[model samples]
Target: MGSLDLEVTVYSRHSSNYHSYKGNIGTVNDNILNQKFNAKEPYTVIHTDIAQVKLSNGQWGYVSAVIDEANQEIIGTVVSS
Candidate 1:
């Protein structure tokens, strides 16, 4: 079986290392590099009461989080191999 890797990062127009994600949205056959930082999102495409599934690179990698919606801090995280 093949293995995959995953990561979370933050980025912004400024140096927001505290809470933002900075990465390249992959193009056709290209790669996507992302950076994660502290951020507050008033709007989201989806919201769940609990951690459902982690984000993945479409390979073997997956990232799930147990987050504190009040603070937006991740209480727990799991990365698949």
Candidate 2:
């Protein structure tokens, strides 16, 4: 690798200043699930989450999805720019 002048891509560590500026951004909800992820029926234990993604055009977007715990299936999804 060194002989061919090739180098591996490396990711830098997150800056402490970034975290300090972030502070507490969201509200903390109660732990109603109690670490029990399994559900006996559909809709009884559905989980939802949102994720930020970088698009090909150098823009950011968000993807929100809801999953059924019992069936382990994605029931709903929404994408926003």
Off by over 4 Å in 1: 1-59
Provide TM-scores for the models.
0.28, 0.61
The models' CA-based lDDT, in order, is 0.43, 0.80
lDDT of 2 by residue, 1-81 (tens): 999998543343422333335678899899989989999899989989988666667565789999999999999999999
Cα shift from native, residue 69, model 2 (Å):
0.4
lDDT of 1 by residue, 20-42 (tens): 34577665552332233333562
For candidate 2, which ten residues in a row score worst on lDDT? 10-19
TM-score of structure candidate 1: 0.28
